[model samples]
Target: MAETDREIKDSLVRAGRPDRVEGRHVNMPVELGSTMVFDTLAAFEAARAERYRSGTLYYNRYGNAASFKLETALATLEGASAVTLTSSGVAAITLTLMALTAPGTHLLVADNVYGNTRAFCDGVLAGQNVEVEYFDPMIGGRISALFRPNTAAIMFEAPGSGTFEVCDAPAIAEACRAHGVTSVFDGTWATPVFCRPLSLGVDVLVYSASKYISGHSDCMLGVVACSDADLAMRIRKHVMAVGDKTGGQEVMLVLRGLRTLDVRMKAIDAAGRRIADWFAGQPQVKRLLHPAFESCPGHEFWKRDYSGAAGLFGVIFHPCADDDVRAFVDALRHFGIGVSWGGYESLVLPVRPVRTAQRWDEPGPLIRFNIGLEDTQSLIDDLDAALPLMNTGLEA
Candidate 1:
């Protein structure tokens, strides 16, 4: 007799349980609480002592069982000694930077990293008297030359924002080790499924769980995973102090997303490469910026280090009027205009990429693309119709 769909799903779910849970299944019940109650004064004192020594939670502000399980799962994926959950990705970045760097320390950042990350370093960290230095996204091992004695940490985002230049993460990690600086990678692009930052010698790994981890664009959460005992303690303490905690439902949603992560990512990865290859052949597209493609910056590094690529990539079109370019995007029937990537639905955003550090300017206007779970033929048709429209003569 054949098994029912529900029974098959249950069995499939059992097969993908996180190893660190010690025989526990992927479905963990949420534990909601404001304040935990103790029956005896001795027990209360014991709890207080535990809270002081280990930063254990007596209230939801610190954490609950749902959040704790999420942290444990993330830590297991990152190969870190521990992980701390935050309300959002920026919260993780803010709290981690606040805990790791002193007011007078220096920070080096990738030029094409997420705009808000650069904003945080400049507006928040630099405002506190910390020196902020921007480096080319393709700096790789050459990053060592810019390190100063007061440099506290280095941040990286692989296949960086807009242009999708894959950095030499291992080389950067080595440079960080030589300078005795903490290395943090925004692993939201690859997540733990494709890249393990700790395995490559990065000190800390951060994620914006709102993207792929939740898979539905519903919840916003962040996770910081690290192997250093001291750094883990610092992040936990900082998160608790600021009350940057995710709720039980969000925690459960992320957990549910994790169960099908392998399946979802496999589809996205395969479909993305197909669509990217098709875009490369279009005459209107001057260049395709995808780490998996040979023409991409740091392609060799991505081939060597990363096991797989995500659904996001960038494209440069032949010089055209703004309206023409907008019409090209508007012509697409499948892809939607959106701010964030990493959802089940495809998206496209036009960008005017400029050179800040070096001469890596685009021949034409730039646009970022996120390939979704749509059929490859449908996405190809949408792009085919859109690319020709971009080359039309414009009335000034």
Candidate 2:
């Protein structure tokens, strides 16, 4: 019988138990090794042949038992045919692009994607002679107009990293399918808990497990889940060629984080929504860029497809000096100023939207908030105390 996602997640925690030492271990043991031994030359040769044919573990760089356990759990969660775990999120993106695009291939990317991704496209991919184009995040079905015969892939990110502009992922995915263009979605914002891109017709789903999957600020990991077996194999081959394998200890940490992901996501979501509602009433705020809110771009698409929202969103402050913006962020006591979200600690960061193919003309300074597992009232109080800083030299 088919189990629910929650059930699958829970079952995975104890699914692949190690062989009984006394009785049975509740979790898969971390098998750290660089080489595998066989009883005879015949067995060793057979294993080598099998590894070449199936791409199984012949070396640690290929992946260990612990990494495979986490990969299995993530693949099942995403409802993907296969998964490739990489050293980091950017590595996953790099590997996926390397596997799919060759020289002279055109790749269409959402304009509001993570800044580093755009840098990768501009720097590395362009250096290799790949044509990169950035389109509006809200383009939806119109994305097809930008495709050419040589267009190899479309990179998408719903509720784009800093601006919180949601994209019509399903519409875009359908358009890509019609044109035979591969679709790669950055699912880090929603993870698999709130949104499943594979079900929405995305060919590849990439995630920065460094954030929500780790659920802590420690380990760095990334995962690429593919609905197409051919693409999955290609990505795996690229990863192997690049020697991009996550550490066993880091994989175990991510596995531990997955165990509590459901509850943590719900708690963080509730806190974020509550804070966003509060921000809506603040006079200094020009607009709230949250997908669950009406003012966010492509909100209708979010409402139509997503089951829930995540803890990250943006706040566009009413026209204020850059100094005031700095003061507001610096005054916050509870929220740390840093990049990356989905951890247990609240964070705030000043963001300046950067676009080449499109214009981001918000009338005021933008600040992104990452709600964390702190007391709601304390967080609200912190914001209330800091918001006055936005008006700080103006009243004089």
Candidate 3:
């Protein structure tokens, strides 16, 4: 059977793990340290030369057995040529952007990208003299018209940050290939479970593992999975140069999370869809921002490209008083008002995406929800109670 035909869920448990040895345990042991001593002078020199190579355990920053294993497993799952683990999601985005573009090069970014990552383009990349340009997330293949001679890479997030807008990725990838520009994608929302960006013709797929891959919301990690060996090597060299490292303990945690990702992702997918549909029928909700819904921009592309939807999505509410919005948020008993999502616990936050390329003249008071593994009715009931609060101010 073809690799695609094989059960990916089974691979989640077995990939990157060695076959069981009679005397050894099933899971690989996590190793922690900075330095490794070699017995022979020749061996030490050889190991030092090969330190930058994957799984070469000469130094802690380079990576250990666990790090290599996680990288291998993630690469296999994503159908990527190689993988690079970084200290944080910000590092992964910055490093890829830094490595791809230089002082004179140009970058095309989606206006609705993660605000934190978008700031780097304005700040650090600006300091480095790289020209950064933001474009409408709905531009689709028309993005080709904006490419300049100095254009190096285009980084975008599908089902974008804060406001969920799915860009036309296959079209964008085609444009990149024609223009000889690199395409970097933030595939955190879909991951490898719901969607694989590499298979969609994207060059690099970066993810924030702190959210779902770590599963428990305890690990702070970023991952880069690339299709091109040369490009992957360039990013890896930059990672080494920056002395960025992901601890073995975090790798173990991520691996543990990966074991159940198939089940959790699907469950969350189902729950989020049900809730997103529920929000659409509410009197206060002006529009649903879910990519799977027909009302969402580029929903057609999402249908054509992605295998399924992720738990993260947004809901736009009709004009509401500030006090009422607060009452609605405060009224929720189960949903946590938090920054990040993709944990076992559900999260809710009011979102106002600052867009430069396009006007975000949607309905007032957009609320984003990250559905968790909670009981469907309980969450719906929690929202059902809160929906009334959007009209009535918080009781004094």
Best by lDDT: 3
Assess every candidate by TM-score: 0.90, 0.94, 0.96
True-vs-predicted CA distance for residue 271, candidate 2, Å: 0.3
Candidate 1 regions with alpha-carbon error over 4 angstroms: 1-26, 52-57, 392-396
lDDT of each: 0.79, 0.85, 0.86
Q: Of 2 and 3, which scores higher on lDDT?
A: 3
Per-residue alpha-carbon lDDT of candidate 2 for residues 1-396, written as tens digits (9 for 90 to 100): 114666655654553345458975556655677887778988878766655223366668777667777777777778888888999999888889888899999999998989889999999999999999999888889999999999999898988988988888989999999999999999999877788889889999998999987899898999999988888888888888888778877877888887777788889889999999999988888889998999898899889878788999999887888888888889899999898888999999999998887888877888899999999999999999889889723332
Residues 1-396, candidate 1: write the lDDT tens digits: 003334333433443244465676547665667888888988888776665223365667777666776776676666678788888887887788887788889988888878778888888889999888888978888998998989999888887888888888989999899889999888888876677778888998887888887787778888888888788887778777777778888888888887776677778999999988987777677788899998898999889878788898998777887888888889999999998878789999986554456666565788999888889899998888777778633211
Q: Would you list the rank order by lDDT, best first?
A: 3, 2, 1
Clashes in model 3: which pairs? Answer: none
Model 1 RMSD in Å is 5.2
Indicate whether candidate 2 or candidate 3 has the larger TM-score: 3
Error of 1 at 98 (Å): 1.5
| Clash totals for all candidate models | 0, 0, 0
